[model samples]
Target chain A: MTLGQQILQQLINGISLGSVYALIALGYTMVYGIIRLINFAHGEVFMIGAFVGYFIITLFKLPFILALIFAMIFCALLGIFMERLAYKPLRDAPRIAALMTAVGLSIFFQNLMVYLKWIGASPKAFPRVIEITRFEVIENVYLTSDKILTLGVALVLMLALQYVVHKTKMGKAMRAVSQDKDAAQLMGINVDSTISFTFALGSALAAAGGILYAVSYGKIIYNMGTMPGLKAFVSAVLGGIGSIPGAVAGGMLLGITENAVSAAGMSMLRDAVAFAILILILLIKPTGIFGKNTREKV
Target chain B: MKFRSLIKMGVVFAVGFVLHLLIKVGFINGYYDHILTKICMFIIAAVSLNLINGICGQFSIGHAGFMAVGAYTAAIFTKNPDLFIPAAIAGMPRFFIALAIGGSVAAFVGFLVGLPTLRLRGDYLAITTLGFGEIIRVLLLNWKFVGGASGYFGIKPYANFLSVYILAVITVVVLSNFIASSYGRACIAIREDEVAAETMGINTTKYKIIAFVLAAFFAGIAGGIYAHLMQAIMPRDFSFLVSIDILLMVVLGGLGSTSGSIVAAIFLTIVTESLRRFQSLRVIIYSLVLIFIMIFRPQGLLGNQEFSTPMLKEKIRLLFNRTKSGKGHTSTEGTE
Candidate 1:
């Protein structure tokens, strides 16, 4: 590929990957906005969703589309379960304790898979359900239909999320809780339920990301989620932790930067680029591109 | 507490030393002996990490990264011992000086990593530290000049149980002293509330940096010991998973309690080793244990409390006094 074409391909991959990052980051950012805590296990939730997709589609031999929906719904329940079981009792506890629990949860899910599978961190092939023969867009540039499908799903999901946040009753309640939990409660909005709903919403998005990821990658592995999860977190933080738009921007930027830098044969600079963005943002504009600079208060 | 406590601890340690000698010379083979040494090494790691996560209230997920720096530093020295030891013997006055320089090298790297990353708090700090851990591993993987992805190996194996225990003792002493001082109180203050601590003039940044560097220092020492013990380590060995294991030790021990960390370290090491028969089921169990603890016993095993009663303390005092007076050595007393 020519230099220009190479750069274009890299950009395409970045944006495609960034779409998933944005999807996952939305989950993180929404929950963080409400509770002011980073759910470290959010990554694992995505991982679980991917595996769920695998089991449903490959093991049960369900149609691919049906498996995707099942993954979303199943993971939504899990998101609700996590909040009720792990997070509800600790609503008043210190953020550190809850954060640790999230970390533990991440470990638990990863190990849960490990225990189920005899091999640890070993890659298992996902059935090649999606055929990518030729969906080329330009001269000597062949784009898979998987990429287009992922992009479409990601866009639709994000739009649906925005609608839920702004144009729906539950979304309005979530907004209220995020803005002021006590006041939200006084207004007769069920704060607990709203948070749960938010979790479910976020998780559904993560499930979509996971299925697409599994489909695009054509393989599933235990440790795969960790880096991508962390990268999405960086995206969430970079774009502004609580801001929806910021998460998208951050995810896209991270995905693009990582791809571009690696494509340039500077693969090692990937993390540095992410962290440098985080540090620079923290120092210069801690709120992020779309995030408002927030101060901690009870 | 009052300087007399050190004397009491010394006598107990001396007795423990004799008991250890008996065990070492007794029915165990080199394999279990190796495990004992590993337990000691992890004890140091767990205890030192407690300084930051338990005492200072900063969640650092990069313990293994600090260890990587130490391991690499010690490995370099061991790999080229002839080059440095003789130069050190000439440049310094004693063999101890070269060893001191080696430990110092590990400690200094701790300071470097701790300087910037320690500024973060809570999950943010955890994320930064986790990133640092991965950065170290990736960088080491890319460092093909030093064997890269294959790992830097073949360091001289000068470490054994005795050296590991001695270094662990030193680490415990240094950390305990540091914790008992006003600086330690500053760290506790951060744990309590950063705003309040800052308002009260604790200089949160200063104490945070200190706690992190100190944690890093001992982690480095433990790493140095580990490098010599395994005689082979890849970048994969120091992955974030290793960091999580260290975090488990600190958390399981009851964060902030030195005795808790030590107990947790030994417990986790033994349990983890024993569970190795289960293969991949081991981590699943560990993760489940962590979850169970978080759900049911968030304060951990012993928590911030001691395993023994106040009455046992008086009994121990009398026993120690008797041992000092030559009534026979008070034996079988362990902190756990």
Candidate 2:
């Protein structure tokens, strides 16, 4: 492959990776926007989604698309149950308490999955659901069908999410609650259901990301969601927390940079580079690229 | 009053000395003795973290990074014969100096990390500290001098139950006394409300740094003790999970209470050890306990209240009086 082809290949890879990140970041940003709490356990939810996909495909012998749908639905219910059980009671507690609970939940889920008879502690090879056909668009510049599928599915889900947040009644209610819960309540919106809906929406997106990720990587583990979850969070913060479009852009940017670092023959420093970017971005622009600075009322 | 307090401390020291002598004479079994030493180290780590998280109200989640620094520093100091400056001067003084150096390095790193990052409140600081810890672990893994992923080994075992137990007592005493002082009040003020403390002329930033550095220093000390006790140090040992375990100690006991930290540390250490028979079920139970605690008792077991003699006496007196009165409800309202 020539230099141009190499660059193009990496760029394609980056976009595919970025879209998965974008899906996860949307969940984080939406949740943070409403509750002002970082849902650390969302990563575990993503992991569970992957495991659900694994079970559906292997046990039921379902097709990939059907398995993906089942995974998303399972994760959506899991997200709602989690919010109701662990987070709902702590809505009025201190921020630290809520944060620690999220961390505890993350630990709990990881350990529970590990101790389960079927999952165990090992990483399972993800089955290739569909045959991959590499298409050579230009000389030496190749794109696989898997990559295109990832990008296409992610774009469609994000577009759907945008519609939900803008074009639908529940979406409008979600917007109002996120803006101000008390005001939304005064306007007769059920704040509780809206929050639950938001959680479900975000979780379904994360499940899609998880399935796509397994397809792209050909492997899934109980704890596979932690690193990606963290990076997506970085993307959420980078794009400006609570902004939908910002998450997409940030995810793409993060993916390109991470892949670029590995492309430069510094693969060992890849994870470190991502975290370094997070620290630098936070120091320079805490509100992120598209975030507006909100004044803290004393 | 100061003299009386000093006398009480002297008596406690004498008792500890006698206990040490008994252990040295094999009065206690080796297994229980090791557990006691471990309990002491956990007590120190938990109490020190309480000072920062509970008293200062700073959300720090990278304590294991500081422990790693201390452990590596002590390991290297004891291993490299050419680097043994104090050890050459005296045989026993070497361990003390190595422990001090380990603590100082970790404290310095804490200062550097906290200087800029501590200004940001809540999750930002928490994430940054956590990142810094991961960075340290990664750095340790890449650096070959300290054995990297293979771990640093072959260090002489100098840490013993007597020294570790004494240090634990000192940590508790120092932290409890500090919390009872004006500086501690400043820390509490910051915990209550940073803006209010700032308006009241308390240097919130300065006090926060002090508490953070102090906590790091003691954590480093615990790490140093842990390294010598095990005679080997590994990067994986100080992962973020360990940090969470330490935090659990503080939260379980009661944040901001020295006695609470101590009780929680000992209780958790024993419980965890006893649960080893259940294999992986221990972690699941542990996580469930954390969730349950947060749901039912978010303020913790003691909720910033220490175990005082007066309270214990009041409880005992109430118990006796209740039996005498033959009624439980009447005295229960007035006793507390």
Predictions' DockQ, in order: 0.50, 0.56
Give the lDDT of residue A49 in candidate 1.
84
RMSD of each: 5.1, 2.8
* Per-residue lDDT of candidate 1, residues B1-336 (tens digit): 557667766874785586468667876677787888899889888998899888988888788988887777766666664755664443213223334554566567656556555554446677777767777787888887557889777765666676677777777778888998999999988988998888898788789988887788778877877877888878888987678788888878887888789888888898888877885577666666666676676666557653434546656767776767643234424521
Q: Evaluated with lDDT, which candidate comes out highest? A: 2
Report interface Cα RMSD per prediction: 2.3, 1.7
Look at candidate 2 and tell me the lDDT of residue B152: 88
Chain A fold similarity by TM-score, each prediction: 0.94, 0.98
Which residue ranges in model 2 land beyond 4 Å of their true spot?
Answer: B84-91, B321-336
List clashing residue pairs in candidate 2. none
lDDT of 1 by residue, A1-298 (tens): 7877777888888999899999999999999999987888888888888888888886799988888789899989999999999988778876667777888788778877777745357787877777776666776566778888888889988898889899999989999999999999999999999999989988888988998998889888876777777788889988988889989999999899888889888887786777666656555665668877556653
Predicted complex 2: DockQ: 0.56
Query: Candidate 2 chain B — worst ten consecutive residues by lDDT sum?
Result: B84-93
Error of 2 at A115 (Å): 1.1
